[model samples]
Target: SRAINADTGVNKQLTQMILKWRRPGQELLVGKPEYKSVIEASLGIPCRHDELVMEVMWGMKRFMPSLVRREKSELPKEDLLPVSQGLQMLLSSYGFDVKPEMVNDQIVATASVLFDCDAAEKKQYRDFHALGRHLKNVSGIEYENWDLLKLATAFKIITSFLQ
Candidate 1:
């Protein structure tokens, strides 16, 4: 709150944004337009929209190395075809360094950090208010719509992997 001056906050926020763990190769999937722009700025170079995706990806790797350091072999098996196919396609398409076996581990760990089961209902999904509370309690950031969107993505991924 105190330090996030409007000036440097964009860069600082972008830096913090990309530092989190993404499932195996997702850190490289700049499917969103915003990712490329921030990454390009971080690299201090422009990236091509089509051909140079890998180069920008490399820039991201150099910018944040700790993201892919952890790997786990045992993962929960929901084995839903769409989920399995989706992950497999993503892995094959992106050539993510994360091995297939470790993907679920990364997904679950990332989920643990990003989403919270409702404190009252426990099994029910948290509403936006609960999400805001949980996120604030977890990360101390005032949870915004963007954070809610991030949590939704994590929830969908985690739910797909759960039995």
Candidate 2:
């Protein structure tokens, strides 16, 4: 969880992507009102923001099993970075001494100065997108196919314990 090299090209792209995706008028956030129900028709199950985040994180975790584990004192559960401080602690435990990356990158750091992180549904979508990118980058997985969904769900179940 070292500080992301903000000056790096990858970080710069990530920043821009996060910003663009978060802007008020973005298509993902402002889905066509009439098309939404149509899109949701087959799924039937309503998609909750927290559930989506859990799913994406779950998928990411499956590709990196060593990063999580369960405590014997309780029923098997995920042991993830529960809060900002916990994230830092996890980094320190891993021998990283630099500024810790935000546990909630989708929550944003650089642009928080210009935008509210808790304003609307868009926030969750943006965060989930950011997290999915971060997981894809950091987990080093070439995830493909429908199985990816299972991978994500598994990670969520484990990580929920730290919540």
Judging by TM-score against the true structure, name the best candidate: 1
In terms of lDDT, the poorest run of 10 residues in model 1 is 74-83
What tens-digit string does per-residue lDDT give for candidate 1 at 71-145?
433222432111333344445554555554465446534433433432433344357557657758876766455
lDDT of 1 at 146: 52
The C-alpha TM-scores of every prediction are 0.18, 0.18
How does candidate 1 fare on TM-score? 0.18
For model 2, name the residue pairs that clash.
58-152, 58-155, 58-156, 59-151, 59-152, 78-158
lDDT of 2 by residue, 126-151 (tens): 55555566657877654333243455
* Runs in model 2 lying further than 4 Å from the true structure: 1-119, 141-155, 161-163
Count of backbone clashes, every candidate in sequence: 0, 6
Q: List the residue pairs that clash in candidate 1.
A: none
Alpha-carbon shift of residue 28 in model 1 (angstroms): 9.9
